[model samples]
Target: MQNLGKADKTTDEIFEDHLLNFNTQQVNATRLHKDINNYLRCIRAMQTANKNLMDTLSEIYEKEWVGQDMLYVQAQNNEMLWADLAHKLADQVVTPLNTYQAQFPEMRKKIDKRGRKLIDFDAERHTVQQMQNNPNRNEAKFIRAKEQMENAKRTYEVLNSELHDELPALYDSRILFLVTNMQTLFAAEEVFHSETSKVYSELEAVVDKLAKEVQKGTLPRRAYNRPLPIANHSAPVIQNSSSMNSPPKGATTDNLPPGVLYKVKAAYKYQAEDVDELNFEVGEIIQVVEYEDPEEQQEEGWLMGVKESTGQKGLFPANFSRPI
Candidate 1:
């Protein structure tokens, strides 16, 4: 029998192209990674070997002895430091020692013959420092400061006494005088205002009285007849018996003709310039004009021949004589 599965070359061809390309890319990438990793490992191994070799060389160099010139320079520097310290300390010690030598020769000789005494050095240095610094052991400065403070205190006390004791009394006296003057002025102003008000009230009352007096009519009718100096003051005597009996019984002024004629009571005011002309007196008959409005009931009247003054005029109700 022949092989039944013959290869499909066309399909296989396309698939093989793709697979070959993919395999080529994967192989190239893997080869590049391996080369890089091998290069890194080699470089690290070289670095480790170089570091170990350097460390071994350094250890060997350290163990092998060099010459002493380097150490000699360091020793010379240490010697210089020691000499500087000795010079500085020698000056501080020499002064104290010399001070002891000059001031206390016995002590100085004993210290020098034996060794330098610590106590003598300390005492002399302390004494020299104290003598050099004058403010520390100064009695005169304390005395001067105390005197200055005392003078300042005395001045302050004197000024305070003048300000607090004497000046306050003067200020209080001036304030009291001002207050008393203000009170007196205020009282005088009040009194003046009250007196002025009282005078004004009295003048107003007098003027009102004069105006009321001038309102009464006393002029003659023709202006030619001599008016009596004053009107009659007596009450009228009624000759008719009908007028003497007080009307029939409940007859009011409204029911009567010539309603409620009554004589003027007294001379209230007249056409008088300073009371020299006619003055309305008690007996002048007045005609009462009855009120038309029943609610008011206020009586109105007209006087006969009672002339007004020169600058004044007589007044009357407009409906004085009309029929009720």
Candidate 2:
């Protein structure tokens, strides 16, 4: 097959190499287009998930809560960042790759035509060689064969020359295209993350402030006709004992949580080490409540309750308190 070209002009090995590279670049560009589209889809999906989460948060957030307006603003900012990043990736990166891929079909047709022309050139060259070798060759026939060979060579050279010039340059342009488009995508990501991070930090601060306000007397957590005795005025403490391990008589059950079986007085001071456990003083009254899950009831002498002094609810060891 290679000798087919040698009948007149030999095939350019360097052109083959460039064509190979060009083909590889074409495949890679196609793959990159698919990957970029998938990435955009994932970003959109995550944005939707975030919107659902923010809406759920908004529903839970009371109007009287601290940073209620700020929460809405932060959620909007997060959504904007997601949208901006998706648009930039689609427009700046994916669109250019699509344009580059468009040329492959035309280039392939040209390449196939060049191969056909090369074979035709070789056939005409053989005809002229045979005519020259014949001792009784007709002058008109020999002249026609020469003319046909020259025309075939010119047609083949036009296509071969065009490919030789363009293929190398097209393959070399791959690096520049990749670098420029990837940089644009990365820059968009950086900006989106930076702004989104700021909004996330602000949302965190809002929750922290609400917790602090609730711990203080600023928020009306519980209002009653009578107030409980304060053990310490300078701390976030819930309960502490003043005397014996006995609760005050006639403690209000209305302020206690729902599903209260009975009130129990703490026989010993219990300090909670985990966030899911309530702390109480020796004389504090604890209102025993139902377990959130059925499995919790199976635990050895474990009970869920609310400490009457500060209204803290969590799991407490039933062995530490007795029914009053």
Candidate 3:
């Protein structure tokens, strides 16, 4: 009887020890599972961060490529417009030169008539000088010669006035018209060249940017308009350590929550007092927020306390409200 009691007591003690050890092991296992889950959550967060970075990079690259392509197209259109201006300027120069050449002969005839009148005046002056120097000159002949000289002098003065005044005015007017036309045509030509040069410069910069992007691996190694496939699109998720280490099969994008999408655009240098190479512009959308500021009424004392805590002078009642 004593031996049986001792054996029964020994068995009970062994069973209690076994139960304690099992419970200890269960607690250890739960702790280990919690640690593994925490580790997995950290890993998933890191992986998600990496994926987000990659997507952002891809989007930036695409925007740059598309914007550069559009610039190239616009440059081409400007080139066409410049060519048209060149043609129009050429026409303008040619038509005016043709008109002036056609009118040249009539202008020459008027100049010749004035030249003959000047010659007659010189001859009449010589006759007057000869009569004045002679002592035995006939009075009637001298008087008639004097009258003829006066008439010739008067004719010469009239011709001189017409040539110096009216004729020159007409000639000057024609010359000014030609000069103004030429100046206008030249200005148009200059504008054409200048516009073309500006377009070429702008296009060259865009092309250079595209080239560097390609070389630096920001853009794909293909033509600008060509389609390319994205690589490595796997998502990250927290996992339980009790399961196998391998990822589940047949995972799709539907498992992820919806995210905002944006198109990529060109990168360029921004100028203030200094130049900054910014990949995005002011009007570009960067992020979306869930809520916006709202105003509300509150007791003056409560507002003062809230302001003191937040270090602000103004406080809105809505700030303390919970989001639904």
**Top TM-score prediction, candidate number:** 2
Superposed Cα deviation of residue 130, candidate 2 (Å): 2.8
* CA displacement after TM-score superposition, residue 313 of candidate 2 (Å): 21
- lDDT winner between candidates 2 and 3: 2
lDDT of 3 at 109: 66
Candidate 2 on 250-292: residue-level lDDT in tens? 3335554457756887877777767888888888988877666
lDDT of 2 at 202: 97
Clashing pairs in 2: none
Tens-place lDDT per residue, model 1, 124-179, is 44444444466675666555555554554455444433434432343344345445
Q: TM-scores across all candidates?
A: 0.22, 0.64, 0.32
Give me the displacement of residue 169 in model 1, in angstroms.
2.4
CA shift of 282, model 2, Å: 46
Clashes of each: 5, 0, 3
Lowest lDDT sum, 10 consecutive residues, model 2, at: 235-244
Best by lDDT: 2
lDDT of 3 by residue, 266-321 (tens): 12221222121112322232211111211111121111111112222222211121
By lDDT, rank the candidates, best first: 2, 3, 1
